[model samples]
Target: MTLFFLPIPVNSPLPDLTLADILERTIELSQTAAVILKSYYRGSPAQLEVIDKAEGPVTVADKAVDRHLLDGIQAMCGDSCGYLTEETYQAGDFQLPQDWVWIIDPLDGTRDFIDKTGEYAIHIALTYQHRPVLAVVAIPESDRLYAAIAGGGTWNITADGVRTPIRVTGGKELTKLVVVASRNHRSEGLVKLLAQLPCQQQLKIGSIGCKIAAILEDRADLYVSLSGTSAPKDWDLAAPELMLIEAGGKFTRQDGSLLKYNQGDVNQWGCLIASSGEWHQQILDACLD
Candidate 1:
């Protein structure tokens, strides 16, 4: 692991790190987090600690790893970046430290974590002008990391640091598409939408990161989110959206508009779809029409 993140005392002047520098450090922080999580699992008590938040279940690993990722990024940004994190974010505190913001979800699927499903992930994204400029989605259990920068293609990186360029599958046949759906959050509307897309295979999975990773790896062809009240926040979508789009996929609202982040409310409600881009309009028409 790289040692780019040096411990900085609170209230001291932060070191200046550009987006390029921050991206490298973010990857390192994620790698460190993967190790930290492994330790937590091994030292797991017979009944691990869990808490119910408004969004979903959170564990000790969620809070602790969130703090570490937030701190590591803050140490490099000085006062130039805002932060929206799942554990520490307060509703009104979405202040603009700067136009550039770091959206993070240190642990994305707490239920999957509790179930030992290895479907959880760590999400980190840098957004400017409401779109991601750099994104990293780290799946610790799989020992894989997916990252994308603006205008740069996405890559699938092994734990040993070998990287291979990745792209979405070209499965455009209406009768043969595979769709990955949320394991924990499902609604009637989602069922209807799935039913509408007749002949598409369905896969229920935890963590949006893992679901999108599946699309990029060609394990699945699409994923959809129809939020009802408990909508997904910016942290849920930012990192993986970049990964998918950079991999030649499409992520958008049901109407095919691009997803914009840090728009004050943070909740990404309503119908959102991610497809392989080969037949996105075809799927959109099937689900919407």
Candidate 2:
């Protein structure tokens, strides 16, 4: 294929692209990254080298797809916008000159990817003024894509390109809630918090994208992460957070604060909760108390 990074001259003026135009481009770029991820994923598992990072594992696919997305977005948006991805990101990379930045997790759930579970996804988001205004998540195995723009409704797109509006299930009692938790990074604090919220069932899954998609699809009512040490970074949560909120759900720190993006520090150290809007406050109170 076709690779998408073409550098523009410093004197070149930036293109005036709207949020809708960017959302379309974001979805296109995510699909490109998804194809790359699937190709590498379908290869022999023994050939995949999993290196241990400070947070978890990273594979060749991660780096390759990260490069693809970063380059593609950089070309599409030009050098005036900031860029951050899990593979190329450093401690202080967020200190860029642009007010708008692209945050990405090219291959989320590398552990599940190595295991060949097909639960991995590609995350891409555009944050304006440190808040996400557009987002896209692409699941290669399912050939499904989810996307949303601020003030626009969330949508699910099938392989055939049929799009459907998605929204969270409304107003379920705490006892009737269906909770989703991390498959690989569950913490003791999260468990104790779950104990307080009497949910109907808990579904463990890989990738923040998939878990948040569950909320958008109405498959699960809530997701909570109370990590003390291994909190999710910006790439992990930015796209998914925007999609969830656009689908009429609420996503916030466990204390009910809104999540800000593109900060100098990428670590989200506080507890995070994603829920349908109706019971968000109740769940936050239950988990925090």
Candidate 3:
């Protein structure tokens, strides 16, 4: 793994901040997080200690990793940007300056991480004027990095500095679609609804970000999260949404609504879907019905 230190000069000129630069900084933080996470992998009883917050299960690794990324973003952007994160902010803390905002999930697949499944990742995104312009999703265990810059394209940054463009598949029929569902975050109603879909296969993965990564990489054709009270938050979906969008995919609520951020309510209460746009409307219509 490359050194987890950021090298971007804060004194660089504005408008010259490339997507590559943003992704580089994101990867830097994620790589740092990877090191922290590896220390707790298959942890001892002491390391496995869990704290039950009202939101859900949070581990020592989650808090530690979040702190790492939070400090990283602070250093990378300084005080010029506003921040929103699952681990750091509350509903009323959405106030910000006008330049840029960062939506982050320092660790996106907490359950998978706790279970030692090697499926979790660090999610980071830079939003410009309420729209995501750059995103990076780093899978620590796999040492793989996936990133995108709006209109700049998506790539898998390898350990040796190689970058490869990623594209989603265009499957023609709903019956041929492969759906990636939530591993620890699904409901009975969603299960029944998925069963009724024309899906040819269903994959259970951890994290909304990971499921979206599945679609962005063509590993699966779609990902659907249908829930009311337990809906996803902007931090959970924002980074992956940007990556999937830049990779030529689409994402929205079940009612075909846009995913907006910093709404004071972190829990985005609605049906969420990410697909290659081919069978997206089909799934969306089914969920609506």
What is the TM-score of each predicted model, taking all chains together? 0.91, 0.92, 0.88
Candidate 1: segments with Cα more than 4 A from true spot:
1-18, 92-97
Candidate 3 wrongly placed segments (more than 4 Å): 1-16, 91-99
- With a 3 Å backbone cut-off (N, CA, C), the pairs that clash in candidate 3 are none
Q: What is the C-alpha lDDT of each candidate?
A: 0.81, 0.81, 0.76
Q: What is the lDDT, from 0 to 100, of the residue 50 in candidate 2?
A: 81
How much is the lDDT of residue 67 in candidate 2? 87
The CA-based lDDT of model 1 is what?
0.81
Model 1 Cα lDDT, one tens digit per residue, 177-263: 889988888888778878888556888889999999999888888898888777888999999999999889999998999998888
Report model 1's TM-score to 2 decimal places: 0.91
lDDT of 2 by residue, 10-36 (tens): 221246765676677778888888888
**What lDDT, from 0 to 1, does candidate 2 have?**
0.81
Question: For model 3, how does the per-residue alpha-carbon lDDT over 1-289 read when each residue is reduced to its tens digit?
Answer: 3322333222221355554665677777777787888888756858857877666678888778888888887877776678888787764635555447888887787878878778888888887766677788887787778877766677888777787888777945678788898778778878877887778498888877778877776788888777754777778888888788877888988788778776556676767888888777888887766
